[model samples]
Target: MTTGHPFMQAHPHQPLSIAAKILSPQMIQTIRKLPEFHLQAWKILDRWAFNSPEMLAQLEAQGEIVLMSRLLDQQAVEHQALMDSTHQLQNGMTEHEILEMCEIHTEL
Candidate 1:
């Protein structure tokens, strides 16, 4: 809400960044230091906010904060899946064997 925040340094005619208004200053700094993929995800969320102001406000009013931890949890799951597949391949498991282990049926 402070006009002196870095995110508020936008051109006089431009609106302040959504992250500045919604996220804590520490959160903004941390997000700025995150990887490109994470930054892209934030950009997507910001666009969603721009497109759905009323919904965002309603969620905020209800005390619903965005859960970046869920994203990290999902990333961990995906990374574990990839590591498992890589290990299987290294152990000479054929693609068919891996697919079968994963219960994914495919027509050869």
Candidate 2:
């Protein structure tokens, strides 16, 4: 890891901790609202450290930071999709507009 990355510097021993902290409030709330099985996965992640086997596996495959970033990105995409779908349903959005919104919300 670079010595100057702010997230890494925030908690060298637990960089992913800083990753969680830096997330938007919406993202945190979405995480809290995750299903029971997903919440269990979060518990497993919470117990992981830089040297943990799972972390090490991710590190070896794509580097830890990249893996964490991708996970966060995926979560954000899923959360946005859920929120957009809910909004569309609540507003009785037209099929054409809903399709446009779906295209706009495509994941990076």
Candidate 3:
């Protein structure tokens, strides 16, 4: 925990209220589009005061952030794969087939 960190100066009782104000519109939009699991993880990260030593220690003990980050990374890889597949299919695949492929991908 750094004393000079922005979260250190954040209103301790407000959680994400101050943090949300600092996020760019594009960043917020990107977060909004995340899947429910990842969205929940982001919310947890957003709500924590990382600059407080006690909170930081507790967070490290919980290991939630590391798990969330790994999950998000895996999701990004899957999303990129799907996007690439969709682009390749756009050459000749029918709309119905594309939709079906997306549904199938999501099921996994």
Candidate 4:
């Protein structure tokens, strides 16, 4: 994807802007351009890159590398919390209990 593409900062949480429209090339290139007809269709591409699972695999196969990502970062935080709790309990908490807790965590 081109880094230099123009973007609209439409939403605080989203990095890219939603375009008002995607115009045909013939329509966009005319001397009297309709700014409203142009939009950041680039975000459609961005969304697939972010939220898609199978699409990421295809992109990886194509050698278009991306950093590993997760939809639920809270899972990581929870795992860390569990690890800390288990370590603090060391001799007090049985291994079976820990394993059961881990299973419950995953189920939830």
TM-score of model 1 (CA atoms): 0.33
Q: What is the model-wide C-alpha lDDT for candidate 2? A: 0.41
Cα lDDT of model 3 by residue, 26-76, tens digit? 444554565644532343335342434354334345564553464365455
**Runs of candidate 1 exceeding 4 Å displacement:** 1-16, 52-66, 71-108
lDDT of 4 by residue, 56-83 (tens): 3454344422211221332344445556
lDDT of 2 at 81: 57
- Model 3 stretches with alpha carbons more than 4 Å out: 1-62, 87-108
Question: Best to worst by TM-score, what's the order?
Answer: 1, 2, 3, 4
- Candidate 2 residue lDDT tens string, 1-108: 123222212233432352253344444455456453253223223333322545434442564355446545545554455466776747765423443456633212
What's the distance in Å from true for residue 68, model 3? 0.4
- In order of lDDT, best first, we have 1, 3, 2, 4
| Stretch of 10 with least lDDT, candidate 3 | 1-10
Name the 10 consecutive residues with the lowest summed lDDT in model 4: 15-24
lDDT of 1 by residue, 6-33 (tens): 3213333322266456645665565566
Alpha carbon deviation, residue 4, candidate 3 (Å): 52
Model 2 lDDT, residue 79, Cα: 49
- Candidate 4, pairs of clashing residues: none
* Winning model by lDDT: 1
State the lDDT at 29 in candidate 4. 42
In model 2, the worst 10-residue window by lDDT is: 1-10
Best by TM-score: 1
